[model samples]
Target: MRTLLIKNAKNIITMDKDRNAYPGGSLYAVDQQIVAIGNDIPYQAADTVIDATGKIVYPGLINTHHHLYQNLTRNIPFVQKTELFDWLITLYDIWRCLRPEDIYLSAKVGLGELLKSGCTTAADHFYCFPNGVSGELIDEEIRAAGELGIRFFPTRGSMSLGRSKGGLPPDEVCQTEGAIMRDSRRLIETYHDPGRFAMVRVGVAPCSPFSITADLLRESASLARSYGVRMHTHLAETKDEDAYCLERLGMRPLEFMEANGWVGPDVWYAHGIYFDDGEIGRLAHRGCGVAHCPCSNMKMGSGVMPIVKMLQAGVSVGLGVDGSASNDGSNMLGEVRAAHLLHNLMHGTTDIGAEDCLRVATMRSAKVLGWADDIGSLEIGKAADLFMIDSRQLAFAGALHNDATLPVLAGLSQTVDTTIVSGKVVVKEGRLVGVDEEKLARMAQAASNRLLNEASLRTKIDYGRMRANRAYPNF
Candidate 1:
């Protein structure tokens, strides 16, 4: 079996039960499982040995929610100022033109960014399938993640309600319920690994309440439970969503979802910013989790999530960068920092600390993805998934007093010095291990340009022009 060893870390922040941290720590892994972790590890010889002299080791940050395909559609001038509903209508045309190559390249660019920023595991919600494209788009992204050596938990997301049926997406982009179920079954059967230390797992997601019918939500939840895989979707993200659900379904977002049996430990909602105190209690009672998207919420003006209250109420709260179009980037470390600062601003300084934000990004995020037993923290028998940053950098010169909180509290230098996933060094010296970063960026940008040009031609809108005040397209 292949072996890997890291020795003499400046500090190792283990997000374990007691929240133990070791100064001058050493970790040893046999193959993909961590075997020893402490201030002193006896055996040092291994196929790989890293002398992390001045580096702070952390449990690799987990991204509980993402739209990897949105990496190609970021910074659109027209939709930058729009809210969630208008943003969906404006971008549906562009997203419905996604090709398999675009998904592959976008995943590479996005996941590569996550890797350099210290995220080892990511869960992507890919829901937009272009009309008449029979290609396996989720498979393309899974391939990209495998090539990058990042642990992946991808949900087979489906949008079944169209504008003709009062949904946000155009009719052409929405799939039939039969088609969605068929593909969901196929993806889970083919890729869902129910074992511990799995590199890839599949989930079932029906995009959101406003984008899917009530019948589809129940069917999707039942199907996910039938396979024992997890369920994920966008829920309670915006006031617009709340308005839509209450107007159409005659109930609040959480109420409607719970009616469809969409609340449980195996289910997680993205951007749960609008849940009230009573709804938060119900969520905790049902053991449901929330993936908090701080940057995306602030950018979309959605509103701040009650993360401080959720944590206090025994809710499993985690961090997500959301879609790159919404967050405009896939930097997990940046997400953690933004979450810390945003919570401090909304709540008080004493409400949530920097280490608490890190915990949300690491351990709690893993729980959201249903991988808490295997890959959340640094411990014996857990997967060897972690990242290290050089705390001796000039950016962290005066801020290394508490290594557990240094990552969230430090400024500027967010890129990690090294990243190892599944006992394999996937990034070294703040760069991807086997990826041609320059080439990937060039190709991804070319893909983005092509999609935008096509979208502009199709819609007769100048997407390249600066139109900060322009009214967005109505689907």
Candidate 2:
């Protein structure tokens, strides 16, 4: 069938078993799987040939967690300084006004941004569903990702505990457990492709411990396991969440999750910032994974995760941009850089280096999502999912000693020159190949404006012009 070749790369940072790097490298692929990769690749010509002479190539970054719809709700003035509980409380009112068009357009904007930043695979956690809105909102997201050509893993996220039932979300956004379970199964049967080099996969994600009931958590895990898919949720994200679990369930957040069968390699939690040393050890022992969202945690005033300790204890820790609302953007490269800098500040400069951050974004992230066999590295028979950066750019002028580290340690210019997914170049010359970005931006802005105005008018809460004057402004 179709074949692709990348030739004369400045350096190919292959995160293989040996963590090899080849200068003046080349890679060849047939159909979607890589056939050869090294300094001396055998057959030369292909249908598509990318001359990567001045560029450094690396395994495409994988995003383990995100809330793509929240791209429309970023930078709201009132919720800028709030912590997890208050932040979710304020945003739930606005998120309850989400429309199907909003979901599609925002997924385009968020997923498009991730593609530009060299993210080839993305796992999005879209959990909010207003009572009267379409229950199949994840379909819109799946459609958007297909159009963009980014390998998508969209979790059927649900929230069953409304404020009326002692949950964080408003009553309007919660749903019945029966409805959530039925939709999740339908999505898996319709779209989940477990075969190698899969372009689309599905996961079961209940919103969070505070936003969903324990019964739903157990049921969601059981449902996902029955279908042999992964499970995701937010856990141990803040001190307030710990307090809530201790008071409401008489257990810590991790302990409660364990009691509900939510711990294992097939499951991953977002923003694991509040786990103790003992809890981190438990996660390691149980083979659980953590999606560490450094940017979102910092933006929400959530404390830093004990990532260094987790890694030392052999826990699978991956980096994610979290949600567009909290991260303010889906820039996976920036997330990698932030992870490197933040950990160095917390631990030492040597504890988590630039290449280590890249590994976390690539290989470790794939492991977190249970996709290590098919993705996460540039190896023979693996999917040729990778990105290229022009290492000769002015920002990387003198930092060419280590091409693997250039992405994390170098100054700006993090936007990639090209991004390939499944042996197809989805982004070329720093632009999306399948999208007209200007049109997408216009439609997204219109959808976002309609959503915010509708929510504001319905609730009489001024989201656009609200002032952040007090130390803690009341929503």
Candidate 3:
């Protein structure tokens, strides 16, 4: 194993127990684990060293929720102005044309953008499996993550309910419960690694309460627990979801989830916007996590999630960019700025500051993904995953001394100068280490165009007409 030392950092914000920030900090690591960190850490000579002078380092940002496949369909004029149900209904027709190569290319673009913006780890929910798309699609995404060297939690997400079953998704996109469980077990047995600092871990996610049957939910939770993996799904994203639950299943969103054995620390939900006071309390009590997607919620016009109240009640809240189609981008730094500004506007106060946003993005996100013991904080014995920024940039001109707050308050979606994942510097000088980003862009654009053409022909919907109107600009 090779030992690497990072010395003379201008600032290292350790999001640890005491929330310490060290100036002129030095970090030492061997292989994948951090061995030491401080102003002056005494140790033997290393095989490699990175001089991080004039740079501010932090624990790499953790994104707890995403749909990497949706990166192929962002900014579609067809569904730009719709809410949750309408958006899903419209997009399901388009998403039914998914392909394996599309998943790989989309994962590269999404995870590549994430790494450039200082995100080291991310949890993706890949649920939509169209009719003709086959052959271990989740494995395709895992392969992409491996190539990119990003720590990944790729859940075997499923959708079972269809229009025939009184669900929003079309029948073509939904799956059989038997098939979902079979694949979930196979993925767990094949890919899951429960040890600390693992590169890839698997989870079983049954899309949502309205999309899947009651049996799948219980079985998924039980199966995930039996293997020590995690569970994830979308919940309480909007009032429409609440109404559907109350009308169809005769329970609130959280109540439906709890009834199906999905309330625990091992479980986390995406876009928890419409949860009530009691539900938040129960989530806190049960140690359940919430992956807050502020950008998507605002774009979909969903109500602001009560993040302050959730924190007050001790709920573990993390950051997520959500689906690329909804968020229209996959940059975690931009998500931080949106969370900081959006919450302030929603709360009408300075109660939740930039520090709080930064904390949730790093430390709390790690908790949400069940990695608090392994990653997140910059500490000894943790995974050596972090990012460094030259804070003397134009965006942070006047905020040099307050480097910690500038990430959220400055509102710049700038790329990091360097990002280190698992003791490897995967990004340097605001560019990927070995990736051909231009090739990825060209390939992704070609794949997206093919998908849109096929899907539009199948659905017979005229996005061109929608763009013709002033409501949507470019299709």
Q: What CA root-mean-square deviation does each model show from the true structure?
A: 2.2, 1.6, 1.9
Residue-by-residue lDDT tens digits, candidate 3, 152-198: 99999998888898988898988898888889999999999899899
Worst 10 residues of 3 by lDDT: 463-472
lDDT of 2 by residue, 238-356 (tens): 88889989999999989989999999989899988889889999999999999999999888788899888999999999989998889999999999999988989999987888888
Error (Å) of candidate 1 at residue 451 is 0.2
Residue pairs clashing in model 3 are: none
Q: Distance from true position, residue 308, model 2, in Å?
A: 1.1
Native-to-model Cα distance after best TM-score fit, residue 46 in candidate 3, in Å: 2.6
State model 3's lDDT.
0.89
Q: Any residue pairs clashing in model 2, and if so which?
A: none
Clash totals, every prediction? 0, 0, 0
Error of 2 at 466 (Å): 0.9
TM-score of each: 0.98, 0.98, 0.97
Q: What C-alpha lDDT values do all the predictions have?
A: 0.90, 0.90, 0.89
Which residue pairs clash within candidate 1? none
As for lDDT, the candidate ahead, 1 or 3, is: 1
